[model samples]
Target chain A: MIAKEKFRVCPDTGFKVFDTTEKLIKINAVVAVVFLAVGGLFGLLVALTRWPAVHLLPADLFYLVLTAHGADVLLFWIVFFEVAVLYFAGSVLLNVRLAAPRWAWAAFILMLVGAVMANVAVLQGESSVMFTSYVPMRVAPHFYLGLILFAVGALVAMFVFFGTLVIAKEEKTYEGSVPLVTFGAIVAAIIAVYTIASGAIILIPTLLWSLDLVADIDSVMYKLVWWGMGHSSQQINMATQVSIWYCIAAMVLGAKPLSEKVSRGAFLLYIVFLQLASAHHLLVEPGISSEWKVFNTSYALYLAVLGSMIHGMSIPGAVECAQRRRGFNEGMFGWLRKAPWGNPAFSGMALSVVLFGILGGITGVVLGAEQLNIIMHNTLYVPGHFHGTVVAGTTLAFMAITYLVVPLIFRREIIWPKVAQWQPYLFGLGVTGISLFMMGAGTLGVSRRHWDMAFTDAPLNFDVPPAAFLMMGLNGISAVIASIGGIMFILVIVGTILFGKKRGEDACRTNPVILPGGGATVMAAGSEGTLKLPGTIALVSVFFAAFVLYYFVNWKYLSEVWPLS
Target chain B: MTEHLNSGDGKSGDSNGGPENGEQRIHAMQSLLDNPFLLLFIGVAVPTVLYTVWGVMEVVQVPIGQ
Candidate 1:
């Protein structure tokens, strides 16, 4: 007979947490935070170097730091946290014991080794090629080997998640379907499989080329395949963040999806069309055909945008529905107004949804358009768009969820509750400023990869408008602020985990959080049982209006650039 | 209502309420999500529309002389 498992039944949500899953979640989360600290430091250096006034590093060092920043923040930190999230969704939410605990540990070790190898390669100054690593500009063999090892490790972790889901099903953990959060995670894992496969297909050959075993690695072919992994990795973030959005809404405010059917449809949409967004990276490439280009950019892409727009609406709609049910139903936005604004979990997610939808989602659709891609394709605007999506949208959402993780999983009280409340806002404001200023600078034709905004040492000196310099200076200040916010988050989470008092069962009973206050009750019988979504409708309309206006504005801008003759 | 979910009184009762009742409710919800027609609609309809849009854009972008 299979051994009976021990479960720590949470007093708050009644979740049966397996000891192994809990341990794995804590290890992965702690490591993710450590990488975030390293990446954030590198981010500061890159930002300062980009600022004309400060100009912190020389060109070569600037490139090295930039490479490290991208690899750590974008790949290492995010993926590590995502592995934790995958385990949480499969084992914790599904109320099942984790499968293959030994294998999971092996996966974590491989990931750690790979991440260290990659970072060491970059810092040793041989692998200064940026995150894209477009070749014939080759790095050392270890650089590619590091990435391959990390990918393999991450892929193994995903298999563990899948195995856990199978265990949940066979063990009859839940009566109906798995929880929606688990379902969303399934989408992320599925996409991750595709992404890792894509990465291996290209990276292995490129590694051979790097080692001089292969004759040549074509640049055009590399970009086409590399983007399949590169851009699709962000799609994984999108799915995971949206999943967290739902979790935060439910845990913090006691919300449910407005319609589970429609919400799942959106996730289904992501699985089908979201990867097409990778085409935006190849829009300017000459080797690609127009038929392929147009199909990916406009036709295939708009459908994917529709999927995101669905989520962009449904997430907040669910939140509003929950808030209104709690008797915050005075006006159209009273649900929003009366929300637990002081709770970092709720506020962080709320800001993530808003800023991402406005800054990231709109700019992404615009950038993907065939004609408008010309205007901002390789400019500072590219990074601006990502910061909005990846940082503002995904990273902030992850940060919001960590507040819940500390209390719910770790069973520790937040060390500084008051400071935690301000962390999201400070970080949100700084990132927003970063996205806007970078986009503004790009609109004035600021080069993206250059260390010097002034281009002082170039053979041919180019004069950009003075506004670009001002934008870079402003971006530097914003980066500093964002870094402080990052530090605050790390301190709050680490301090809480290490030093905060252990909570008794009674504390868990009264307040679902290990944090200071109680969460709003999540009742199945919400006011949302009857459809009352006028507030959400109005909000969604505003988003639609902004999208249309910005899209048209980009088209107009494209028209003004070297008239279509 | 708030008190019910907040204290988790409702959740505990629902789980212990009866396996049959819980399974029936879940079955009803899962059927809609699992329907082949709905799955096809979700997976295929958007890409088909996108393809049509691609065709139109290609026609629009055809050079004036050619």
Candidate 2:
């Protein structure tokens, strides 16, 4: 062999500086926060309108706000933040620079322009198609155009992520296989591309219809394709949320998954399976073939859920291992006691996992079932279930990640650490209260999107008792409480960004903090500080198994028969 | 020009080094291009593009039913 000279390696891994990924994350976080505020305002309006006593706004205004809330919060805020997270994971975690910074900027601008145009059009009363923007409920051409532009921008961002992944592999920046978090994000990006493509398929025609280029469009087909966008986008949110859960756990607790291979394998399965799982949304819709519906709602949905479940179990497994390493002698649940409860990232993530499992997961699985869906479809329970998943699960995870990123990227201390500590609890409690109330009313046959339950002038078919209406009013109050928590969160975030103390000497330190784990034998001290492999793998694997189990059940039950027929 | 070149190398990697090390770096970059994940991304992306085009074509062909 030719004599090879050894190159001196940089100690810090040079991952932080060259990556402009952190800046991208900060920008996305700010935008997402604004969108969350806007979305919350709309949600408040809708809640008040639904409250029998309040009836705060007129029917028309109610619909507008309801539509805006869904579009802005569910679609816009989540997707934009997801793109930013994708950029962060693909570059920072993988130790690669962005493929094209200029292109990334272009994508952001396009998305912003689209969001602005869509909002303006909605406010002007030009498009009242609701968040689905279904055909036959025509909106202005600009509305569709804005949506197209945003989707295109997101598509470009995905391309850039893939490009960066290519560069990272070429650079040999990562020693082993890609990290679990980055792998999960890559899967999310892949699904996002498909979801956006589906959006373009439906929206372009709707735009044409608005321009009078086409006479009309099929409502049923439009719904089908739109769900391809709608439902699939939500799956992207799930994947991204799961990825963040892993990252937050790792960062805050210094926890690692027990089995890297299993966790990574679960992520790969998500990419292959989640996109096709959009059929669950159409199970209750008429005109869709029974075979397609069954295959979609049961089989595909189960697969997606299985992916989530695996991650759910895996995260806690890592936490347990980390706790044991920190010299906690508690038995099966002893690690939990020793774990850092004060850390915002750890608490937020732990709470999110619990809420998602008990509330979100249960409601999601039940709703995906054909027979159960018929009862819950278009009820207050529908929004209740989704809020548990998307808002409580995904949005809360994002907030937890933000707590970490704010310090790392913005170089600021957290303002109002005390108030920030209570945010997740108050907000989560309020959401749980509201969702439970809605679920109760829904069980008694309460409907959604109705202006007035008291107005008997129209023929009312369902016999909903007066108590249900009263309970809905109570739900509205819970929403108000949640909104207060949300406002406090925003203030804390803004304060941190503007005036938090910047870390000075501590910025140069790179010692890996050791977390509590299950045993000392499994924890080895090395140059990297402490290695807790089994715990990390266990944490990641539990969620992987849970997600797989959900999908398996869904496939077995829902995919075999078309519930609609 | 010299300053700009120096900065790029300093940020990225050491450009002026032993010929053998430089050659190894070049080989690494080439190997990265042949990564399976990169090829997988491209492979999936092409079909996705094609499907998008096909879906768009269907939209263009069918007239809106009044």
Give chain B TM-scores in order: 0.39, 0.39
Tens digits of per-residue lDDT, candidate 2, B1-57, equal: 111111211332224554632332333432332343653464245334332333334
- lDDT per residue for candidate 1 within A58-161, as digits (tens), equals 88999999999999999999999999999998898877899998899999999999999999999999999998889988898899999999999998998899
In terms of docking quality, model 2 is incorrect
Candidate 1 global CA lDDT score: 0.81
Q: Assign candidate 1 its CAPRI class.
A: incorrect
lDDT of each: 0.81, 0.69
How do the residues A1-565 of candidate 2 rate in per-residue lDDT, one tens digit apiece? 3232222211222234343566666777788788898988888888888888888998788778878888898988898889888887887776677778778888888888888788888888767658887778777888889889989988888888988888777777664345667767877887887788889988888888889998888776787678778877887888898888877766666666645444654665566566655556666665555555555566756776677666776677766765686677465566776676766667778878877876688777777766657666777777787788887888888887787767666666788888888888788777777777887777566876667755456675566797898779888998998888788788988888988877443443532121222111111111112234454455455645775675466455444446565
TM-score of chain B of 1: 0.39
Instruction: Please tell me which predicted candidate would have the highest TM-score against the true structure.
Output: 1
Question: Per-residue lDDT of B4-37 in model 1, one digit per residue for the tens?
Answer: 1111223222232344423323334345443323
What's the distance in Å from true for residue A554, model 2?
15
